[model samples]
Target chain A: MSQTDIASRLGWVAVDWGTSNLRLWAMDADDGILARAESDLGLNKINDGGFETVLRDLVAGWLPDTLSDDNSISVIVCGMAGAKQGWCEAPYATVPARPETLAAGAVKPVLKQAGLDVHILPGLCQVDDPDVMRGEETQLVGFMADHPDFAGWVCLPGTHSKWARIANGTISGFRTYMSGEVFALLSQQSILRHSMQGADDAAAFENAIRHISVKPKELLHCLFGIRAGGLVSPDGQQAGAGAAILSGYVIGSEIADIMARLGRDESIALIGAGKLASLYRQALHVHDFDAEIIDAESATLGGLRRAHAALTKS
Target chain B: MSQTDIASRLGWVAVDWGTSNLRLWAMDADDGILARAESDLGLNKINDGGFETVLRDLVAGWLPDTLSDDNSISVIVCGMAGAKQGWCEAPYATVPARPETLAAGAVKPVLKQAGLDVHILPGLCQVDDPDVMRGEETQLVGFMADHPDFAGWVCLPGTHSKWARIANGTISGFRTYMSGEVFALLSQQSILRHSMQGADDAAAFENAIRHISVKPKELLHCLFGIRAGGLVSPDGQQAGAGAAILSGYVIGSEIADIMARLGRDESIALIGAGKLASLYRQALHVHDFDAEIIDAESATLGGLRRAHAALTKS
Candidate 1:
């Protein structure tokens, strides 16, 4: 049976699971959208075991009328499912993976109470470096499906941002940004989290972009001052929450630094959540570069679907 | 039984063992000068049961008159010996620790083949943070001992650099800098590493320093461009090395930014391998700051002695 028959016969299922967030998609038999659901049921949410319970609870309402043992539910997954502790650990796919190169991914028999025949998509890995991509790889696959001709750097910005170098319809190389992690650390763990007192002020955020561009070198320096500023400056300017300052420092620095390296390119594609995507757009706009903000949900679903289709045929 | 008497009668016998470096100090009873012996036989060298032999080999002629059971020899150790995998696990001394805090570190139960009472000093741990310190803390302790009146920020630059806030006579607080580790990655791992055509030059380092202080805000931008300058720029005046450019960009930006928060009167102390120390001294000095450079060996030795005295007396 093909994806068309499968989609028309059963509900179109799509799951976008990432490091910190999990998004689920439910579509009618015609692949038409029925309803969308999202939960904090991210992989990082409840260790490893809780995924099954959480996933079941989130999708229980969408379960079809009658299910047979042989006729297992056809679903594809992306994101950290390929990680060491995800649903079914998928091995990394080497670079230059073609469209048909996509597979069910390396599978691991996870301890399961329910028999959910799930095929987690494998993220592309840069063997030469430490960078890895699971969910975004599916997104890239979707992008490929949409525009086979599109190439150059496809950027997916988030807590852990990803930069992919696409050439000749192949992902030649990619790099992961610790931007998200850095942001979290600075905002919460590190002293910089405290310096970020005025988070609500969008102006501070914009101004940070400008300041960071002009003084990108101050990134690391600003990090040290989150606490030092509180001690030496008595006005309490640095005494507030550090996240506000750290967010500015890290995000602003990332913009300036990444922009400088990427050059004044209009080729970069922006994909991520609300504030992060907006901030990225604003940063690019400041430099007079055009960035197309891709629908994050669409990207994940499209990517997941392509992987789903690819796996069904095999 | 006192250290003073044991030293007077024993001649020059000092031991410095760390993660990857070991040294033996031979001095007179009055702590006057004597021969110094060093070897690469560090704690890391003896994976299992061999540190004792390595030390003995390094100090071939420095052994006691007769390895008698009743007449035990006294030796003090400072560094990773307290670490889980070190020669002996000395454990950690919590905050508010004084020069004598780790003085009573437990002696290694295992006997050296020749039989010696080896005392390992406890490492230091911060009260508020999880960052722990080992050999470097002892080195910092030694610095405090030498400059009893010294108070302020002590910035010891190295692979894992440390910055401690010293008030009056006590080390009130301290933080570590991944500066060295970061530099190594930028220079050796990153794309920028490839662009730098040559070894680090004083002029280049100084130039980068000037750039950082000039703007202080564009530091990250400076870091990002080191790689692109070679690829995108027309003149590519950033000739020679991307690595060196990156190094300069990183080091210069680090100094400018970190120093901006520090008040003029704040004292900065540096401890590291000679070259790293010299480079840091020059970087900070050119920024119109004075720093005191200490001998790594002496500092380690002093720390060991201080801890030895503390533990034995306690």
Candidate 2:
């Protein structure tokens, strides 16, 4: 095969380290993932000195096979691994750093070891509003790889949901919402969680979307009613779920706000895992936009690999 | 001294018992509050069995000597004391029930000790939807007492901010915003609380209100920037006060919805302690309407006594 294939079969290791879990992917040089190792050893568990050892043990086997004569392996990283608690808070590279211009940043790889080189990609950020991000950073690279002419809004929905306004092969501005995290906390952990059971009841949720999307003004008042709805309700068990309905109500209202601001003509793409993207797609369609959901993991993997390839060449 | 004084004093004992504090005002033959006792024995402390004992100790000295001569001395009670955790969960009187009507159908009070007469006013509620009020019941009654000819909206700002519409002497509808509670929790007890040191910065808060009232739409994006406003700010102590700004933003937005629905002609009156009422009046005026902030403690005391008098007459 090609040099990329050789690298693919023995692909360098990639890590999607999040707040709770660390997912490791081994890909061939051709950019195809071969084997994967995952663990609950996320940044949260690294405790004090355990990050290196934990990550070391998780990928101890996959590393050797991926190395080439160049004495280096293409290691791409993303997610909270860049946070203070992460494996290492690799700094972010400001905008205008294209796939070709992206940097091959520093990584604190396992020490006292040999035969491997690591390339952790820098996160993309807006200078004016430095705290916001486009996780589609790498994904945009992959998106660009797939559709060189692609430009518009690339919406990434997750724990901290991100919406990026993409233009001219570059991401210009983006905003983040605690949408997914808020959903989880309100739906399962918050006091409103239990009352909203059987949320799988699509009919109830559909009816809810309609209610919130149309009368956004009623959202705040409707939320407090969640508890009251349960108090005077014939179905006491539905109280928590009804409270969650308020969760959906708030989310739907926020989405409606974004939709209105984005206007009708811009292209909307829902980028994330299936279920989340699907939900956003459904919410967006109400505004008459046909949005499609993209697999976040794949986008992340492709995006990272492309960045590594571009930065090394540059 | 006067007709209103006679009605206020000799009516009966009026009590507002909540989770944290217990307040009781004893009216004389003239409906003037002859004696008042406030105690730390809030319902939260009663657990399961001591509600009666705690309440008795608070009011034993204030009880009228002539009480029980015929039917014993009657009292009107409201607030969380009538909730499930209180003496008894006085059933909610669905919407359209005035203070006079709700007091008439209070739950049957159980006598735990010798020579004790007590009655708990039921909570006011909405039947078509699920919302209830206990303390505000007295406030609404008091509002009517003070402004016998008043019509339109009365805004009560506190832990739970309430906006009630009164037309033709009846409360037609109301909406509750958790703005006050949200402010307390975020600025006092939450993770954000630690990040903020809003200590003694009324100036920051006042300036924030001006900003919010001036450009209302900044609310959607400003939430995330709160951290930046203070952290990246030269003023560390002012960071905490940012919540006040956020509080103003949310409250202002809520008022916008109300003003839009009612149009400018509706007279908006503020009924509460002066400082709290002033904050709301400014928020309302920013949206282009003048609001009158009325002293409410006396009115509420007057209201509870009025209800007790009406009950005794009935």
Q: Best by lDDT, which number?
A: 1
lDDT of 1 by residue, B73-192 (tens): 656777776676777777677666667656755566477465466677777766353345777778877777888888667777776667777767777766665456556655655444
Q: lDDT score, residue A252, model 1?
A: 71
Q: Residue B204 of model 2: what lDDT?
A: 53
The TM-score obtained by model 1 is 0.54
Predicted complexes: DockQ each: 0.09, 0.27
Tens-place lDDT digits, model 2, residues B1-314: 44344333444667888778878877776776666778877877777778777776776666544445364666677777788767888887776756677667676567765555577877777756577677787788888877777778888887767778886777877777655654554455433454454543556555555664444434434444454344334354445576666666566656655765684456888888766677777777665678877777776776677677777677
lDDT of 1 at A246: 56
lDDT of each: 0.65, 0.64
lDDT of 2 at B238: 48
Candidate 2 TM-score versus the reference = 0.83
Shift of residue B83 alpha carbon in model 2, Å = 3.7
